[model samples]
Target: MRARVHVLVKRALSVVLSLTLLATINFSAHITSAEAKTRKPTIAEINEAKKKEAEKKAAADKAKAQLNAASNQLKVLTAKAVAARNRYLQELKKLEIATKKAEIARKKEEAANKKSNAAQVAVVSSKNHIGKVAANAYIMGSGFTDFDSILHADGPQDLMDRLSTLDAVGENNSSILLRLKVAEESARLAKIEAEEARVEAVAARKEQADATARVAAAKKEADQARAAQEVEVKKLQQMQDKLIAELLSARKKRVTLEQQRQLAILEEALAARAEQTDVKAKVWPVNGIGFSKGRTTIRSTESIRTNAVAFAKKQVIARKPYVWGNEGPNSFDCSGLVYAAYRSAGLGYPEWDRVNSRIYYSWTKRIPLNELQPGDLLYYSYKADISTIHHITIYAGNGMMWEAHNTRKGLLYSSIYSIPGLIPFGGRV
Candidate 1:
């Protein structure tokens, strides 16, 4: 009987030593994690939105550049239009002067033509008068002729008078012919000048028309360019607005991440629980598996062998990479790890994401922190309802939990307090 008692005492000492070692190691690791988090980060700020937003910024810049180019082209086209319009106005002025000059030349040409016609009539009448006089002289012979008159004259005075009369008539005819020739030359020159004026007026009108057409074409081009620039400006503004919206959302996510970081640094779960509650975490049944002061109901555990087997299974799968929706022996997500761990230990763990199972997992009975044992599931949420539960971590005891948090930090151990949000509840399989 004494030998049996000694064997029991040795067994108790071994158990106590093992628990003490586990607690010490857990405490040291928790402190170390806290210190690591507390170190002021010398690394640059990084986030999902940070890298993704660069593409948005690049596109915005390209749009802005295109908008500026469009604006410049519009300005150039507008200037060209203005120049064309000015040229049109100048050409119109020139055309008006040319048209007035052409009208004056035409009037001068008509006046000269009338004078030429009058001179032609006068010359014709003079020639006819001279011809009639010659015919009478020829018919009347010596009496009508100068020589006959002279021969019949009684004195020199009569002969001299006849000679003077004949010379005066010839001089009158010569004067009339010279005047007609001058009038004809003047009319011809005036007509030629009038034709040239008309040609010039036609050319001026053509120039004005061309200038006007150019102005119209330039104005149309300017209008189109201006419209395109306006569209680009609006698109640029919208891109800038989109970038601002993304920045706002990113700011919110960054703030949330910062808050979680602070909690991790300041509140180690085991230290927080010890300071806040009297019933500390342990596998003992007296006060560990019963009610706590905070009205927290700590449930009794199943066989130790079952929980130990699940925990061993989890340890074996530790460091496995996290995938989005995978739950396997190779890759696991947050809830996937939980499912595989408990299921490996012969527990009927749910086969869905923790968020989906939150509202309907009544089979995995609720337990408080005091009743938490290895292999139990820890759920975190920001609100009272089960819908708020967003993440799940498996309790690995010794103040640590196993999680497949994300792709970057795959399967790893973490303190319970470091998890974002409040501990909504715990589920035991």
Candidate 2:
């Protein structure tokens, strides 16, 4: 009975395993069917969606540009206002110096007037003293009767003393008068100088006051200008923010779709790997060449040689530096480099060089980045210049990209993140 039970258990386990296997197969088949139904979008759907997205992006870009222009204008106005304010302040400083000088001059003038009046009084007193000394000399001479007789009768010492006394008296009177005259002249000159200084100081003060008023007026104007500019900037910012939000929403939707597509592709790859018994060597569609090369060659040729050369060229230029306007030899501008490299290959590039040209419609729509093998076209947009695609690069796999950039750094390979404003679009050749 133990052996019978063991056999029964083994049978039950086998049945369970079989059922499990069958269920797994059925589930896998169902998944496969669902996947098949949800395959990549058809060309028409892609084109339509792309068109819609392009329209929305265009609108967003226009709004952004307007906002940027307004911002720039506001900056210019602000600078002007600042300059005006500085000029007014400078005038005010000059005015202040002038006012101080005027006050000093007035004080000096008052002092000079006082000195002049004292000097005048001294001059008058000196003249009166001289008159009194002359009268006394006359009276003394009269008392001597005859001047010659008195001279002869007197001793030589007496005559000498008399002459000496007369000389002393005359000298004292002359010295006092001379001193008084000098003082009076000095005072007069001082007064004149003081008055001139006072006038100059007054003028300076007036100028200073004017300057101060001007500065105040300028400040008021500057303030008004700043306020106006702020209002304009705020309005512009609002518009820009609204447009950016819309752009972000659209980008999010696109990202969602892209994620879904990537997930689906990953599922398919896993399924294929599971079913395959033998691992096959993975082959690149365009050997030795990259997406950039194909894009470059496609501009000039439709031949197979063009495609091959483009591929080789891209591989060779994959490590080139990026230059804003560089077209060859190690650097490149976005579209120019892309066109040049593809032209080297046999693939025909878009007829128009501009990003917004009608020829890009098909390319932008049907190509998804994950579906890109080799020789896919890459588009890049500048967030600053959203109206046009400013750059293009070839995908070099391994998270590397090659492009011709500005003059500063010619053709070069750069991480996508290194570019501040780059928005990427992947498309097939």
Candidate 3:
């Protein structure tokens, strides 16, 4: 009875399994029928898509170029502002010197004024002294001479002594007048010096005013220059920020379009294969898990350490400018980009050159054509020899590769094996 029950359970499980298989088959058929009903895109449709994509790329490139121009302009404006500020400082220094000279002149004028007042006082005192001497002589000399005639002297000797004393008094009066004249001359000289000092003080005050005006003008110019520079810098910054965002958006769109293109290519290839072989269309895995090429089912792991790291680095640097020999950050050359990509994965592949390109091949394992994986380097050359390889790129699978292509194209993605060169094989590091 136990055996019979076990048999019944086994039959029930088999029936359930059969039903699940039927459902899966029905689902597959439905998908195939849906696909069959749809037609491939026409040439016109493809051309229109290409045109739209081209327009977007052109706009993005134009924006990038404008941003570079704005950056250069900002540098120039900054220099001009600095020069203006320097000139302003120099003007300010000149004004300071002028002001100091004016102050010195004013002090000199004040001293001259004091000297002039003293000179005026001396002239007045000298004139009054002359007048007093003259008055005394007139009164005494006239009255005493008249008395000489009215009152007779006791003897000739007394009369002679009186005339002689009168003559001595007249001589003293003449000496007083001479001293007064000298005082008047000194006072006049002092007055002349005082006038000159007053004129000098006026000139100095005017100079100070001019210096102050110059300082104001220089400060105004410097402020204007700084304001202009700030305005332009802010404008350029905003424009550059906008352009950079557009650039990134363009790159993201390109990535999406590239994905769609890869899918379309795969579908076309699979459809053609189905028509020729008369078999169910299968979705073949390129970089994802569970890739079965034939009898061998290759179950790729969910993640590859080197591949993840290297591809992540490439994505970070995508759409950068292609400089002649630059290696990273903002620009790169062809081989330089490849070296960077692997280095980002912690592989540290050296830069590839005509001589070192061959050396690179030696460092990596030669992968089979069917076993090509992401992070593998695809080498192209003029000849089959590795030494002749002129270009290298990082493989991203699904017929895509990342590279710094040319000066015009910059760092971008491309379809694998589509490039026209002697591609001998792929290498894995």
Best by TM-score: 3
- Comparing 1 and 2 on lDDT, the stronger one: 1
lDDT of 2 by residue, 131-187 (tens): 777676568664432364346557878777766765677689779988998988989
Which ten residues in a row are the worst by lDDT in model 2? 279-288
Global Cα RMSD, each model: 17.7, 19.3, 13.7
Q: Estimate each model's TM-score.
A: 0.40, 0.42, 0.43
Model 1 stretches with alpha carbons more than 4 Å out: 1-58, 131-157, 203-429
User: Over the stretch 1-429, how does candidate 3's per-residue lDDT look in tens digits?
Assistant: 234323533555676546534543453343233222224455555566666667666765676676577667657756765765676566667657666765665566566556656656766676677577568757865455636633666677877777777677667656655655665565566556655665665666576566557666765766676677667667766766766676566566555555555545654554343333311112111221111112222212324435543553455344578887777657777767666655554543233332245455555566543456777766665432345566777766544567777888777655444454424345665
Which has the higher TM-score value, candidate number 2 or candidate number 3? 3
Question: Per-residue lDDT of 307-389 in model 1, one digit per residue for the tens?
Answer: 64355444434457888787776887777766665556554424332434354234356665545677666665543334555
Task: Indicate the worst ten consecutive residues by lDDT in candidate 3.
Answer: 284-293
Please give the clash total of every predicted structure, in order.
0, 40, 0
The TM-score between candidate 2 and the true structure equals: 0.42
